[model samples]
Target: MLFAVEVAIALFVRDRFVRPYLGDVLAVVLVYCGLRAVLPLRVLPAAVLAFAIGALIEFGQAVNLLDLIGLRGNPVIAVVLGGSFEWLDFVAYAAGALLALAAERFIHR
Candidate 1:
């Protein structure tokens, strides 16, 4: 349902500014990590999995897999995915994953 909503919002909204807001993949990653932290899960493995998923999303975009799947290739998605070689998104993912790990520690305690 969430993925459907994201795709719908991305496709229906045609404004330039609205493009970026379609689907905040990075923020989603952060939220996913945050949830992991809140849950009783292994931090390292979960973080690694999040990082892998993020990387896959970016790489998949680079290869046009998303486009093939009917998802428009927007610059915003590219930007979020580290577009050619964006180190920032990776950093964001790492930060999110780490934050989730940290949050888990505090919450579990």
Candidate 2:
């Protein structure tokens, strides 16, 4: 359910002002994973799951899978995934993940 919301936000809000902030997506994923850690899950497993979800999103963009649901082509996702190789997206993802980690720490404290 959370994952579905993430994907829905990605598809619908990608073109909004936050479109360039891929970090926001990563941060959201991290927060979700962090909160889920309240269960018996380990951190590495949670991070891997988040990464896998991100990878799946990138692949979906690459294959235009979202188009089936009326999402227009977004060259940004391709670039973020290294098709065109924009370093900024990487930084954004890192920042987002770090922010999430920090937030998790604060919350857990």
Per-model TM-score versus the true fold? 0.52, 0.47
Give the Cα RMSD of candidate 2: 6.7
How do the residues 1-109 of candidate 1 rate in per-residue lDDT, one tens digit apiece? Answer: 5545555655575673433432444355464655465877566777777777776766775676655665456656544453343445556657656666676679889
After superposition, candidate 1 runs with Cα above 4 Å error: 1-41, 73-85
Evaluate model 1: give its lDDT: 0.58
lDDT of 2: 0.53
RMSD of each: 6.4, 6.7
Candidate 2's residue-wise lDDT over 1-109, tens digit each?
6455545555676563365565445544655575566766565455545555555555565666656555445555533342322334545555555555576678789
Error of 1 at 1 (Å): 15
